[model samples]
Target: MDGDFWAPPPDVSPPVPGVSEGYPGVSQVMSHGYFQHGGVTFPGLLYSPRSLEAAREFPVEDDDVFNVTYQKSGTVWMLEILSLIRQDGDPRWCRSVPNWDRGPWLETLLGLRRARANARPRIISSHLPVHMFPKSFFGSKAKVIYTVRDPKDVLVSLFHFARIFRPYRDPGSLGDFMDKFLQGDVPFGSWFQHVRGWLQLRGRENFFWISYEELQQDLRGSVQRLCSFLCHPLSPAALDAVVTNASFAAMSHNPMSNFSLSPGFILDQNRGPFLRKGISGDWRNHLSPEQSRRFDLVYRERMEGPPKNPSGDTKIPPGPPKNPSGVPKSGEDPQGTPKNGGDP
Candidate 1:
């Protein structure tokens, strides 16, 4: 079993957009259970167990583990990879666990059983900040495979999510979501900080860093690399099963894999399905040219080069603006500023 998932790192100086506290109808509304960064309303609180009573200390077996990332990034894809690795690349096993509950996110399963000892060797998933991770998960024994995606895509996905999930009912369009994301008001904290914290833990044998774009570009290669990192020897049969089930076609339609169903633990799904479009570069459809440029500038300024795969071997140049607060200027319309320059 894996140890308690930790919290993501603190936003060094999270952005706080100068949004009018609340729109007339939608102001003061909470989205995804948290207050909008500059919006008027605050989200409700989550009811955590507070404590896992004598949760069995997860044994450090073979010193390999998987810490899947939060939503939006290719989590489902990676989940299938981990499941295949743990199940010795069995398609039958992949079908058994399904995609949504793939091995990495075991902390969520704690609610299923009373004691941790009864739990299987877990490949768990979580969105907890790096700071909040249990101390036991560090070092060589427990590996954390962190998968990150471009923030532009993440913002777009979150926007659609707010629309579908109705978490806070954002009256502001995708522009507003972009503003909030750059501002760092969402649930798991700033995306930059999340990547930064995990990257900081790099160089250790236990850390395996991969990117969504790279995975999308080379699915099987990525899977093979992941399996190698996890020390799981893959047979041709096992590899075939993992590749087949982890495809977008396979996962997008499958209810069990899609995570569309409310698992009771997560709430506020009346707005939209958790798994929206699982494609990369979807932000291009949402962000206007001008807005996309602004996003690009901000991304280059804040998150330049992510760590390379498996090894976490890369040079992270000490950059400026830990939080960057890259939200648009006051009175600027995020939904593509009008040519005449008035808020759309």
Candidate 2:
């Protein structure tokens, strides 16, 4: 986990590109302080077109490991687990290095450089959907560990996350946020699309799926599965160390893992800690009965699409946009003709 690679601190004034107008036939959310780039929505102040272009062309090394997830779906947790596994369950690397450095978010400009510069067997993380991911990753021997969570929980988490996160505006009332979420208006685009798109990679030799619910229920088992997937098994004692350090309590307390070390301008820890409750079903407490029902309808409708075949393809509602040739296209976002681009 410890490497000679050291990423520079993010720019005090990071480059936020001037986003172009949304293209025709795509789902564009230029509102809510977000912007459309290649059919996906992103925080305008955080990401740039140059970084995204780099991501599209990043030459994925065969020995690389990718930690992929949608927003607020245990992204940092997975990174910590991977770090521990790389060191055979040593916490020293995890304690000293911030989570972003552990494996930079590949969508950012700094992270893009860090990922490209890292040594082989690198740990690269991203929140990008399949269409937007590096094109080279498709046939590479690289391994991907994707984290899925109940979108309802993701909704609750993202709502709070936007409050303190400098790039996002206050997510507004929970009810309003729910409506926007279902519409895929928030950052990183739609939760349904993200999960559905990545789930399509299941059953591939190099792809492994770990749901937040499953991990919360049996972390040890999940860790074991990860070790098996990565082909880096730990001794029982070492495995114990990994589990102990990666626990929610331990992570929350660690400045490296938590966002406590972040500057106020970037992450306002005063407003909320990045690591909130680690348990599942917290959404139940926050969502009204009506909200829950609506969530269920959307989730079931999309996730329960045409049965997946051996190749892992399934027909999904609002399925990933493709080129006219009828094959999935890389390096593009949804086809969009935007009516407006502001959060109303």
Candidate 3:
């Protein structure tokens, strides 16, 4: 991963040796998992274990498959749902495949093309910024399901995740982390840009938006709605099985779905399990009233009107910033980057 993928403090060095290098436009060294392009850094593969020529090349098929979401937003749950749908609700079959293999992130899938070619009804996941997807897949028959969370929860989740997985000397407090997130210093670019870029495509036939909270509240209904969009419906018994398999308690314990041991795949050796609490409103426990208000202000300004592709989960819409710039007026970090290392 590119060291520049993260905006570490000035004193911290790159996490993985030889994985980063100085770029002219970029102020610091970039990591292997991220690449700098046009002054913007993107999450991508820096190298493949196998020859690119020998990698599997699957056909897009013009069928109704999907590009899933960015991380920390119920991605695991969505993957399980996709697996169940593809298996037609066979509990045993769903249990057979690991989450990584079944719904691999697009960047990770590049080296595993051979394994991907054989997977039927291909379900690909991504944390690719909305603007970086393969152009061919955008308007074609393939479908897209973009899932967005309340930015507060996203920042909280990402903070904890970075402490465990990302290469940093320290993970700052919620207040400090929020400062970077607001400044578009977080990985995958600005949260507003991510949402706005996709919402721009709302109402398109191949696009669908879902929320993590709604899926948590109504698994069966969410699955049915997703099936309806794909023109695939599960039999009554199959639906029941999918719901049971997707239960939080069940998935939390399932090795395939749970990301406890997944650190070895892409993260540093000492990082924490991928799935932390898997609960909503975690921010309430960490974000103070003042901090919450600040976040609310930013959210209101960034999302002025109702989401262009509003899912039942989100209640807030976009609005003008409390501050015209959508950021605090002063007394904030002028660096506009995250302080690296430690727990938040």
Per-model root-mean-square deviation over C-alphas: 13.4, 13.2, 12.9
Indicate the TM-score of model 1.
0.68
Question: Candidate 1, which ten residues in sequence have the lowest lDDT sum?
Answer: 1-10
For model 2, the run of ten residues with the poorest summed lDDT: 1-10
Tell me how far the alpha carbon of residue 116 in candidate 2 is from the true structure, in angstroms, after superposition: 2.2
**What local distance difference test score does each model get?**
0.53, 0.72, 0.57
Global CA lDDT of candidate 3, please? 0.57
How many clashes in candidate 2? 15
Candidate 3 segments exceeding 4 Å error = 1-35, 42-59, 109-116, 167-170, 263-272, 305-344
Higher-scoring candidate on lDDT, 1 or 3: 3
- Which prediction has the highest TM-score against the true structure? 2
Task: Identify the candidate with maximal lDDT.
Answer: 2
lDDT by residue (176-257, candidate 1, tens digit) is 6777777665655567656765656544556666667666766777777777666676888878777877777876766666
lDDT for 138 (candidate 2): 79
Question: Over 4 Å off in model 1, which ranges?
Answer: 1-64, 98-118, 166-171, 263-272, 304-315, 318-344
Q: What is the lDDT of residue 67 in candidate 3?
A: 49
Choose 1 or 3, whichever is better by TM-score: 3
Of the two candidates 2 and 3, the one with more favorable lDDT, higher being better, is: 2
Per-residue C-alpha lDDT of model 2 across residues 116-212, encoded as one tens digit per residue = 7776779999998766788788768998888877677789999989889999878889999999998887778788667666755644667776667
